[model samples]
Target: MLDANLKKQLDTYLQNIVSPIELSVSGDNSPKSKELLELATEISGLSGNISLREAAAGRTPSMSVAPAGQAPRVSFAGIPMGHEFTSLVLALLQAGGHPSKASPELQEQIRNLEGQFHFETYISLSCQNCPDVVQALNLMATLNPNISHVMIDGALFQEEVNQRQVMAVPAVYLNGEHFGQGRMSLEEIVGKLDTGAAARKAAALDDKAPYDVLIVGGGPAGAAAAIYAARKGIRTGLVAERFGGQVMDTVGIENFISVPYTEGPKLAASLEQHVKEYGVDIITDQRAAGIRRGELIEVPLASGAALKSKAVILATGARWRELKVPGEAEYRTKGVAYCPHCDGPFFKGKRVAVVGGGNSGIEAAIDLAGIVEHVTVLEFADSLRADEVLQRKANSMGNIDIIMSAQTTEVLGDGSKVVGMQYTDRVSGESKRLEVAGIFVQIGLVPNTEFLQGSEVELTRFGEVVIDNRGATSMAGVFAAGDATTVPYKQIIISMGAGATAALGAFDHLIRAGS
Candidate 1:
């Protein structure tokens, strides 16, 4: 269907448009700027050719041509950096080729409510967790381009945000209304999206993750936070690196007030289940890496996607501290690991050592005794530090051996694989070496807060973010909760309370800013 001249021009455009050389010139020119310039000239020539072709066909000169076989898909609104790049390019290509019909029945419905939305998100450039918020929004927009998304940097958009009454990065505005502040689930958007009453005029939009609030984390604190936040009538979203936080590595949670005998993971699961009843957005395996702070928050993911949000709650729990022993890092996946539940099954019939004499070490050793051929528990303390019950259980396990007053001096490996370990006796000053197939180090955990550098916040001596009774950090428009902060007596129940407090503080910040 293409005329000879038009086809030649189209092919030429495609060929030159994708070159790195064309992306930039060596001097002061920028890649994107030059790329756009080159594209404009090509488009102009292409447009002129199309016009002439239409005129010859007896159609009006202003009429658009069908390129090869398709209609052009045009961008109706904003497309900045991050995941929007692909969407924008695709839209332009489709616009040049063919228009696509709405893929879902909800298309028309979204169009009706399109005029009612005004969304803005704010985020910090340095924050790792901010990227998830970016992807969620981009996905929503791609699902229906009628939904407009505006991104603003939280640091730079401070003045505009204060005018809008925003107290944090990652804020959303719906129909000129403040939707909420913090990390949101698709469900939250769905709830705010008007698909009812007006459905008689437009088709019904299919149900998706329409959330009121989304709490990210599955630790005791995350669960507790969700219980409180969701009870307040908001759809919550929860994304955890794992189901539980540091406590999940714990054998038991003794000081959790009333829960006399509860394990970490089970408790986490219970909380997760409870939050699900309230329709919280629970996403596991989704990690936030980079944040774009502004009126709208954009979070880039480890998977190269992004999520956007109005406000965000970080319940990303911390990881246990490693001894950083020699060979530890080198042999990580080959024969050393942290979580026994995840890697224990692979070590079946293999000899392994669990480092540490604390409750965690003993607990891990006992668990591994059932799976691995042999379990060696190493302790640097004079005697076992774990509770009497755990010690008793470790003693009863025939294949489990406890070596007290010993520390791992070196982790030995064969470059490509872990082979053994070197140990020193604290009392006798004697050294011993043991060959093992696997090593599971369980000392304790470090707060997963390394990503908050350069942000307006205070960190404890231990590097945890310091916060007050209300989960208010030293900075304005910013607050932190969960294991990453400096709330002592790190318990699941306590963290949950802390998360709830933080969310409330965020709510207060939003109310004050909005009012």
Candidate 2:
């Protein structure tokens, strides 16, 4: 049932619809289906222009919204609950002749696009990042008949999800081929589509003449390195599966030195822009599979292409460590989540739990407490590991509850979504169950250095690349930085400084070799 306050807000948003929209719901008469239907009916009742109807049996719960005369080109298959609720609302507004949120340049590109293109975006209902991508694709579909898009609920279609090997939400497939994953900007989406439509593949680089510097990864560290190397008038090349790395998944970042406050995507965009200002060859959508050291270092790509470089800088960042408990994997997008910033909105007005009592966990709890009904933080340690200031702030929040010595045993779900979780008290040896709509895991991070296996790169036991003060690795002409390295701190400012140091070290190596 919709809360009165939420219903009122939805009513206000719907009242401004300038055109009529049709919402078609479909599914068996199961409890989930009925719940979705009831919500749809209530939404439809709020506005006179909006109407609802049931689709044929076996079809998933989908909404096909279109203006009075136009046929629906955008369809969403899922309950559109959680953070996805905003996606539904935006879709309806677009169908009702509202202006698109995409940039004018993007809209022009979409209109100019030719040939048939099908975009299938897999999303978890709770993922906040998924909506922007889905909405952008949907807007493209609405603008051009040749382009079409559909949103697939990863949790509802387990078989399809497994077939695609979807590891995370916001996984976009272009023309049945996996395009990319995570929070992608409109430019990235359009660029991928352009490449996919042309059937372009990575080409092997000529070993005879290698780049002056080749950077692995495309986070703040790699981007900074590229810019610095390019400033030295060298042939700089950067290879990355995605430009922003883990920063794209992050939200508010206040401690970035000069920048008093900024969001992750905003900072990432600035980094990419700064790198582009130089002569760095930014190669996106490519993963470094392995490295071979010789006179010229060779980095092999997962796409079967190899790039050779005189010097290499490894800045492959880290990913959030997962809790390997039961139901954690099965209900990853359903209820269990890693990024509170990305999925917190979906749990609005609902009780949620956060596993961990570190600074990140406490920050997540405080951030979620503003939107969610209540936030319960469970920590395995005897006391909170967060800073005293952060702990005090979290404690002051009435909606936030901190539980110490609580070890998460399992995530409990109803085969569709997360319903609650079980934990054991470390001190008391007592088991307890907490009914929660979602669980945000804020464990530490694991470095992404598996590609360095069998390579000459030195690494710590935790898999982080070993580096010196100058960011120089054990191997000559090779460097490492960012969270993947043995840096004392894993902050953005520190990574950028490390990257600059590595670039300077590489430049010095090149100068000495030339001398």
Candidate 3:
């Protein structure tokens, strides 16, 4: 249910629509179904041009928006709540004859498609990236008769999620094949569709010609390393599953040293552009499966290709550590999330919990306080480890409540979504429960180093690659930087500096070895 102010705003938005829109709501007697039906009824009542009808229940709760003349092919298999609320509104607007925001080229491509294309995008209500992919597929489906799209909420369909091995949100299936995951651009989706390729080919690797310096990971650190290596005018190569790494998931980044303000995607674009300006052989959409340390390091990719490099810079970054508690995994994306920026909007006006007292957790609380109704921070330690400045800011927020020495025991959820969290106060040895819609786990980070399990490269107890002052690892001709390594801090600026140092170290090593 929307508040008075939001309902008024929606009423104003719907007043401009001229075309008639039909909303078909179909579901069983489930709670999710009742919630969706109530919301749909309320939304349809706001506009005279819109109408709501009941459809036969199928496998799951579903809703569809049909334009005046077009058949109903665009459907959502779950309640489009949270950040996806906008998606539902936009679907209604589009069904009411509003034009799509897709580029002319993309519109033409969708219009001229010959073969039938069906897209099933599995998404969480909290994912910030899902909206773009879902909207793109919906637009294509609405524009073309042969194109059909379904947005499936992964949390509500755990069996399907497990069967598909979907470990992440925004997992897309084009014609029943896993197309890709994460935030994808409309143009990228169009390109993939037009090319009819589920996976993009990496840059050709020649075993005979080994690269002088090969950089792994494509975050800020790896990008900087590639730029530095390319400046030497040597054969440099960079491989990454994605270009932006953690930076892509971030939203507001005000502390990038000199930059006054910038978002994550903008910074990621700039990094990619800067890397492209040089002669760096950048290979994307490929993950390094393993590394063979020898005279020439051999890095095998998941795609069955191998790359040989005289020197390697491991800039692989870190990911948010999971709570690993009961209901945490089950309610992931349903209410349990990692990135506040990515999923915070979905919990607007709802009470949420932040599981951590460090800088990230405090920051998350501070950020969510402005959007959500309330924020409760649970710290495992007796005191928060975040800087005084962050703690001060968090304390200033009236909506934030910090609980120290709190051990999260479980993430309680309904069969379909999260409803509350259970924790224990370490000092009192008493358990407690907090009724909240979402939980953001920001305990810490885990380095992306599982692929290097048997490699000669030394790693710390925490699995971070051990590096010297110059970013050189224990093994010769091997270097590492960024959060993946034993770096003091995991900031973007520091990672860039580390990457540069590693590149210089690699160049110096090559020079000495050649002499």
List the global CA lDDT of all models.
0.58, 0.83, 0.84
**Leading candidate by lDDT:** 3
Off by over 4 Å in 1: 1-218, 233-270, 277-285, 290-293, 296-311, 345-350, 371-374, 396-399, 427-430
Error of 2 at 480 (Å): 0.6
Error of 1 at 320 (Å): 2.9
> What are the candidates' C-alpha RMSDs?
20.7, 8.4, 8.6
lDDT tens readout by residue for model 2, 199-224 = 23454243324799999999999988
Candidate 2, which segments miss by more than 4 Å at Cα?
1-128, 135-144, 149-181, 184-199, 204-209
Flag clash pairs in model 3.
none
Evaluate model 1: give its TM-score.
Answer: 0.52
RMSD of 3: 8.6
Candidate 3 residues 1-515, lDDT tens each? 77898889889878767799888888888999998888889999898898888887454688988886567878899999865777777788777877776557568877877788888998877676677688878888878889888898877877887677564678889899988876776656776767742233333443336899999999999999999999989899998877888888776788899898986767887998899889788776678898996667888888667789999999999998999999998887677888886667667688999999998899999988988999999999999999999999999989999999999999998877789999998999999999998899999889999998888888888999999998999888989999999998899999999999999999999899992
Candidate 2 residue pairs in clash (backbone atoms < 3 Å): 82-346, 83-346
For model 1, the local distance difference test gives 0.58
Off by over 4 Å in 3: 1-115, 118-181, 184-209
Candidate number with the higher lDDT (2 or 3) = 3
**CA lDDT of 93 in candidate 1?**
38
**Candidate 2 residue 318 C-alpha distance from true site, Å:** 0.7
Residue-level lDDT tens digits of model 1 in 245-302: 5564454567778778875545655776787787766655456564456554444455
Q: For candidate 3, what is the lDDT?
A: 0.84
